[model samples]
Target: MGGMIIVEEGALRIVGGLVDGRPVAIVQEADDVLFRVSGNSIEDAVAVARARLGAGGGVPSQRAPVDVPVDAAAPTPSVPPRDLRALLRAAVAAFDPLRSEGVTEGPGKDRYRKIYVAGWPALVHYEFLPSHARRHMGVELHVETEKAAAVTGILPALCAVVRDAMPGQAVVHDPNWVGGCGRLQVVFPDTATADTLARAMQQLIVLTRPRVEAALH
Candidate 1:
């Protein structure tokens, strides 16, 4: 009902309408009462209008549809979650010193098994803490130095630096100053994956070694 074209001697009007549920544009002309043109879609209407007006050089060329590969659209495989104990074992096995010389159990059951860091008085270790329901793991560096106060004093700054570079929280604990011992620990949840633990431990060692060495000096 909307498609209508009115022609006068010097003026013309074109009205738009729908054809088979798709919108169409009506084309008209001035100066001469010529034939009308209609298009099913806006693009078709625009093309018809341009062709009628002698614009856009000529009718627009049609482009061929592109074909996509099936393999390119396929979903990738996901990595399965690892068991806690197995993940911990994998993380411990990743350490170079532990792989070469093996680990030595500490004095008590809760304490970490020591892995010596070459050319330093400090030793690296890993321990698992089990509570009533939850469990936590820690990768720690214990330094044996006579100046316990000096080591503890530099720890805050060192912890700040290490925290910025690492994933887990960095903590310093000095329970027995008489023995000239203190520990710098990176704590992570037991639910963490082997890869995550391994990467965190590696980052902890890299960030902590130079700081502990400087503290000892």
Candidate 2:
């Protein structure tokens, strides 16, 4: 069993097992292990721990006792640090429409990846800004199609639909965006947490998909 270390909305815990005989601490949001760190001592592990807000929501105020297993017979399974694609995967999983419709991830380079549902006119993308910290990434919905009619005719209406649904959001209609592929998207704040970003993308997908389908018909 894991014992609480940082007891708040996004919780971290020291698992019972050790890695290479070193204590391990992990940031777990429900079943998904968002991050992991290990060091010679418990304090070392905690010092380097960085995590996203857990899906579980909140944690108990009290810190539970950590029961580190005495047996060093075998090491715990190592959880590699999460990358951009992993973050996108979490965001996709948070939304039922994306998960149910089945999204595909295109080959990504550096800090960007393209994700889309089968037969959908719009594609979801996440890109990390060089000026911003790693957590401060940008998520966008691009209306990509070979037909000029879709870009010239349908994009403005789609942008209006999204802006109407998400008032106060800085939704934009960029005809020249992404080399004139054009898109309607809102960039999330740099300060937004992982959970917040995921929720924002989920909201966009739910609001935009119907209008996109309506246009296609």
Best by lDDT: 2
Instruction: Tell me how candidate 1 scores on lDDT.
Output: 0.44
Candidate 2, position 28, lDDT: 43
Q: Which pairs of residues collide in candidate 1? A: none
TM per candidate comes to 0.44, 0.46
* Per-residue lDDT of model 2, residues 49-107, tens digit only: 53223323344324543432211111223433335455554544454343435555554
**lDDT for residue 205 in candidate 2, whole number 0-100:** 66
Q: Tens-digit lDDT track for model 1 on 1-217? A: 2222111122332323233334444443421124445676444554565566554474332321121122111111222322445545566656544332223333333333455545444333333322212244566655555544566566556655764665223233433433645555565544455565556666666676666556556
Which ranges in model 2 have alpha carbons more than 4 Å from their true place?
A: 1-98, 121-136
User: Global lDDT of each model?
Assistant: 0.44, 0.47
